[model samples]
Target: MLYLVLAVAIAGEIAATVSLKLSEGFTKLWPSVVVVAGYAIAFTMLSKALKMGMPIGVAYAIWSAVGVAAVAIIGWRFLGENLNPTMIVGLVLVVAGVVTLELGRMH
Candidate 1:
């Protein structure tokens, strides 16, 4: 249940970030609306996750790491944004760090 909330938070954040890129400095209408709504949903869900007993350190780490990875993938695959080897390595490091964080929590 807590993880479900966190997943929603992550999805909302990813949507918000992707919409932000498509907003064209807020000149675009629907995408801009999505940016606002998505962030609202993201934060709301994140708060819910926290209230549901997810530690802030773990929740935020997962949320941010997943968001970063999803947004980068979307940008590269759909938005035609540059994603080079360096960025790939960086993303790998981010994922590894998040995994470490999760693993550390089990101890």
Candidate 2:
């Protein structure tokens, strides 16, 4: 399904981003490889989902937004990054926007 493909793309993107931080400016070998591979797979999956009839704008929006949120959570949990109340609110708004876009397409 297109949605599943999109989810995969988003997950890959998040993994890539998290690995990027661990890559330490590309000086780390394994994490650097992971970053590159994850991004490649993410883009490949995204292209496939687009070919499956999902609108580019919708797919890209969902992909980027979800990727951002997932990466933020990963950073918070694993990278000692902090999320203040404002940041949490902003993330919620992003989720709401994604939900609104999905709902709009249902009719």
Best model number under TM-score = 1
Residue-pair clashes, model 1? 0
Q: Candidate 2: RMSD over Cα atoms? A: 0.7
Q: RMSD to the native, candidate 1?
A: 0.7
| Clash pairs for candidate 2 | none
lDDT of each: 0.95, 0.90
Tell me each candidate's TM-score. Answer: 0.97, 0.96
Write model 1 residue lDDT over 1-107, tens digit each, in one string.
88988999899999989999899999999999999999999999999999988889999999999999999999999999999999999999999999999999989
User: Which ten-residue region of model 2 has the weakest summed lDDT?
Assistant: 98-107
| Model 2 bad stretches (over 4 Å) | none
Model 2 per-residue lDDT tens digits across residues 16-93:
899999999999999999899999989999999999999888898899889888888889988999988899899989
